[model samples]
Target: MAPPVVPEAIARDYNEGAFVLDRSPRASAALARRCLEQVLEGYLSATGSDLKKQIDSVKEKVPENVYRGLHGLRTIGNFSVHLNKDTNTGQIVDVEPEEAEWTLEVLDLLFDFLFVAPARAQERIDGVNSKLKASGKPLIE
Candidate 1:
């Protein structure tokens, strides 16, 4: 599969606002959830393991606090998919913008660490050296 494109707009929003600032919280949350789903699916596909089992294993492998944080993110993502609605008004009552931004930020970091950084770190370092040599910009130094 082709690599995922990190959303430039979201990065810009994060850089400018110190967080993701798009107002569509539900959409952002859904996107973050989708990213997590993709990662889990990829992991399962590679390892031929069930996602739930893998998550359980991960919980055992990680520290309690870290596992709790992951569990909380997973819960937020799951609830963002299944809950957060008013039956009468047909409005979403629980999905918060801050929560969505936070989820997205965490997902971005996870993706960068797990997928992008390992794949591109060497290339980026070389590119930085090349650019520095060409322009004397001291990109690394």
Candidate 2:
């Protein structure tokens, strides 16, 4: 079984909405983190991996590209979660609107890729395969 494709139109609309909202970079980052957390929870549930163990295992099994994606989410998520502190401490020195917009876009991409797309695909694939197996049907046609 494979996950269904996410329509480009939906993706575009989602991105556009985010842009229209003009959310602060910090808010975008927080939302991205929440999305990532949902994906992680779904992955763990599907795989039946112990939460603590899975977190540790993912650190090693994730490919470089995937790790990079997660890192982006983490950075943005952390930024948003600690926005006030970061801003006050001068950790986030840039306060320009454009820069903030760019940050939001990046975070949105990260969340969509890491959480929404993959999870949905995996769920679809798994569900189809499970049904076929239960019906005593071969996976391949």
Candidate 3:
């Protein structure tokens, strides 16, 4: 099932990222990072130019696991673009299969924290309220 997103653009990039994971981990990482940034900045109101700083603004706002995991993903996605690497072998730096899988896992964690668990919890709360109303009992506030 498609993960719930605040906007369609985020969903588009995220799904497209997952789609290209096997063929190109770099693109997958890029799109995943882009989607992450959008969710943080656009939805959560994180402020900053780069993902690192954007992440920084909201680090205290999210759970500890989300904060820790974001850094790992940023490293993987920004390696080729941001980090300084050895130029001796002239080898291209790209994301590995494990890294791509890990990024997806991180995305899952973030989505579950931000959207899924809350939605499910709300549904259960509403169900209880409905039962309470039918029984003429006090509803949970």
Best by TM-score: 3
Residue 58 error for model 2, in Å?
A: 1.4
RMSD of each: 8.3, 8.3, 2.1
Q: Which ranges of candidate 1 are over 4 A from the true structure?
A: 1-21, 44-54, 59-69, 84-93, 124-141
* Native-to-model Cα distance after best TM-score fit, residue 74 in candidate 3, in Å: 1.2
Per-model TM-score, in order, reads 0.52, 0.45, 0.87
lDDT of each: 0.56, 0.51, 0.80
| C-alpha lDDT of residue 45 in model 2 | 38
Clash count, one per candidate: 0, 3, 0
lDDT of 3 by residue, 18-129 (tens): 8888898888888878878778877789898878888888888889898888888888878635554559866667788779767777878888888878889999999999
Q: Tens digits of per-residue lDDT for model 1 on 15-55?
A: 43332336666555655655555655554232226434545
Candidates sorted on lDDT, descending:
3, 1, 2
lDDT head-to-head 1 vs 3, winner = 3
| Model 3: CA > 4 A from native | 4-7, 80-84, 87-90
Query: How does model 2 score by TM-score?
Result: 0.45
Model 3 global lDDT (CA atoms, 0 to 1):
0.80
Q: Which stretches of candidate 2 lie over 4 Å from their true place?
A: 1-21, 45-56, 83-141
**Residue 98, candidate 2: how far off, in angstroms?**
7.7
lDDT of 3 at 37: 79
